[model samples]
Target: MTPRQRRVAIVLGIVAALAAATALVIDALRSNMVFYYSPSQVAAQQAPGGRAFRVGGLVAPGSVRRDGLQVRFVVTDTVQMLPVRYEGLLPDLFREGKGVVAQGRLAADGVFVAQEVLAKHDENYMPPEAADALQRAGKEQP
Candidate 1:
């Protein structure tokens, strides 16, 4: 091929490679993306059935049950409640009637199987999503 044609082909090849790389990056991000939902949303079945996602709300008062390393609790937005089961050490800040965000997938029996649990770090700090959820449920942040 002529010199000009050779340069054009090289440029086209580079463009194709870049496009492929971008596509791959986007796909990876999409697959690993985890969305945050409130207890109300979960009650309405807005969360994905088998995919992992985040649920943020207040831990229901007197709803925590511990069985060895397995702990069960209910998260509520004051409008709806979702049961969560976690099998690990809970954060020191985790307590009843406090804000929490759990990452996990929903089981077939309608329980959230949490892989990770995060509690509020301070007396006045709540996650934005949890605060919004509480407000939407007509409850002020505690």
Candidate 2:
């Protein structure tokens, strides 16, 4: 082959390799990525069953229950509530009637089996997801 032809072939091979690598990366991410939702969003039943995801909302008042490291709470957007279960050391800000986001799966029973729980770090701050859910629910800051 001519030198020019050889160079063109090498470039095409490199391009093909890059395309394959990109596709693989995208596929892997698609499988692993878990989306965030609110209690209302969870109530909509849009999440893929048996796959992990995140849900954020206010910890419903009087919904916090603890059994040592295992905790259960209900997250709410005023109009809807999602039960969440987590077994781990919770953040210091975690409490009843606060903002929380849990990463886990929506079980067949319609509750969330959380693997990790996150709390808002500041008193004046709420998670954006929780804020959005509250806004959608027409909840006013009190």
Candidate 3:
């Protein structure tokens, strides 16, 4: 092939490779994306049924129950509440009436089966998403 044709072929090959790489990156991100929802959103059935997602809110007071390694609690945004079940050690900061974010899938029975639970690290700090959810639910944290 002529020099110009060789250059054109090289450019086309690079463009094709870049497109493939971009597609791969986008696919990976899409698959790994986990959305955040509030208790109201979950109650409205806006969260994905079978896919993993995050729910953030305040742990309802007097709602935590522990049975062996399994723990159950209720997360609420004041407007609505969601039941969450987790089977593992909880964070030291986990407590009732505090901010929490749980990652899991919604069970067929309407319970959130949490794979991981994150509590607010400090008394003065709550996750932004959790705070927003509460505000949207017509409650303000102290």
Candidate 4:
């Protein structure tokens, strides 16, 4: 092969290798990725089942229950509610009638099994997912 043709082949091979590496990385990350959803979406069965995801909404009033290291609460978007089960100590900001986002997977029975729970940092600072959910729910309200 001419030197020019050999150089072209080397470059093409390098490009193909890079593309393969990128694809592999994306495939690996896809499994680890967690999507965010709202209680309304979850209630409507729009959220993906059996995958790790985030659900954000207001903590429903009178829904917080604790049993030693385990806690259960209901996240609501005013139109729908999703039950969440979490283990371990909750953040100080976690409370009823507040915004919260739980990262986990949905159980077969429909409850969210949270691996992590994050409460709003301040009264005026609801998570973006929670705010968007509330807005969407409000617009859908009759």
Candidate 5:
């Protein structure tokens, strides 16, 4: 083949490889994507029906109950509430009326079975996803 033809062929091969790589990356991301939703959004049936996702809001006051290592709490956006069950030790910053984000899937009983529970690290820093959710619910952290 002529030098010009060889150069064009090499360019086309590189483009094809890049396109394949991009498609693989996008597919990986799509499968791993976990969306965040507020209590109100979950209540309105906007959360993922069967897949794992994240729910964020304030831990409702007087709604935390513990049974041995298992803890049950209600996450509220001031307008709606979502019941969450976590069977593990909670973070030190986790408390009633504090911003929290729970990553898990919803059970058939309408309770969130949290695989992981995350609490704000400090008094002023709420998770960005939780903060945005709270803001949409007409509330903000102190």
Candidate 6:
């Protein structure tokens, strides 16, 4: 084969490899990508059952119950509420009426099984989306 033909073959090989890599990355993202939603969104059925997602909202007042290491709390965006279950030590900052973010999948039983529970980092700082949701529900600025 001519030298020019050899160069063309190498370029084509490189393109094919890149295309394969891109397809793999896209497929991985499609399987792993998750979304965040509030209780209102979940209650609206915007969150599909059995789909993984992060729910951000306030730990609903008077909605926390504990059984040994397993804790259950209702997260609320004022307009709606969702129950979350976690089997671990609760964060010191985690309290009823405080903001929280729980990452997990919603079960058909109507409970969120949180793989990770995140407490608000500060008394004043909440996830912006949660804050916006609260504000939209008429509970803003403390």
TM-score of each: 0.94, 0.88, 0.90, 0.87, 0.82, 0.88
lDDT (tens digit, per residue) of candidate 1 on 50-112: 889999999999999999999999999999999999999999999999999999999999999
* Cα shift from native, residue 23, model 1 (Å): 0.5
Superior by lDDT: candidate 2 or candidate 5: 5
Q: Which regions of candidate 4 fall more than 4 Å away from where they truly are?
A: 1-9, 139-142
C-alpha RMSD between model 2 and the true structure: 1.8
Q: Which portions of model 6 miss their true places by more than 4 Å?
A: 1-4
Look at candidate 2 and tell me the lDDT of residue 130.
78
Off by over 4 Å in 2: 1-5
lDDT of 2 by residue, 1-142 (tens): 9999999999999999999999999999999997888888778887777789999888989988999999889998788999998889999999888888899998888879999899989888888877887887899643
Better of 2 and 3 by TM-score: 3
Please give, for residues 88-123, the per-residue lDDT of candidate 3 as tens digits.
Answer: 999999999999999999999999999999999887
Q: Which candidate has the top score in lDDT? A: 1
User: Which candidate model has the greater TM-score, 3 or 6?
Assistant: 3
**Candidate 5: where is the Cα deviation over 4 Å?**
1-22
- Rank the candidate models, highest TM-score first: 1, 3, 6, 2, 4, 5
Where in model 1 is the C-alpha error above 4 Å? none
Backbone clash count for every predicted candidate, in the order shown: 0, 0, 0, 0, 0, 0
Better structure of 2 and 3 per lDDT: 3
| Candidate 3: worst-modelled 10 consecutive residues by lDDT | 133-142
User: Relative to the true structure, how large is the alpha-carbon lDDT of every model?
Assistant: 0.96, 0.87, 0.95, 0.90, 0.92, 0.89
Name the runs in model 3 displaced over 4 angstroms: 1-4
- Inter-residue clash pairs, candidate 1: none
lDDT of 5 by residue, 1-142 (tens): 9999999999999999999999999999998999999988898898988899999889999999999999999998888999999999999999999999999999999999999999999878888988877787776565
* lDDT value, candidate 2, whole model: 0.87
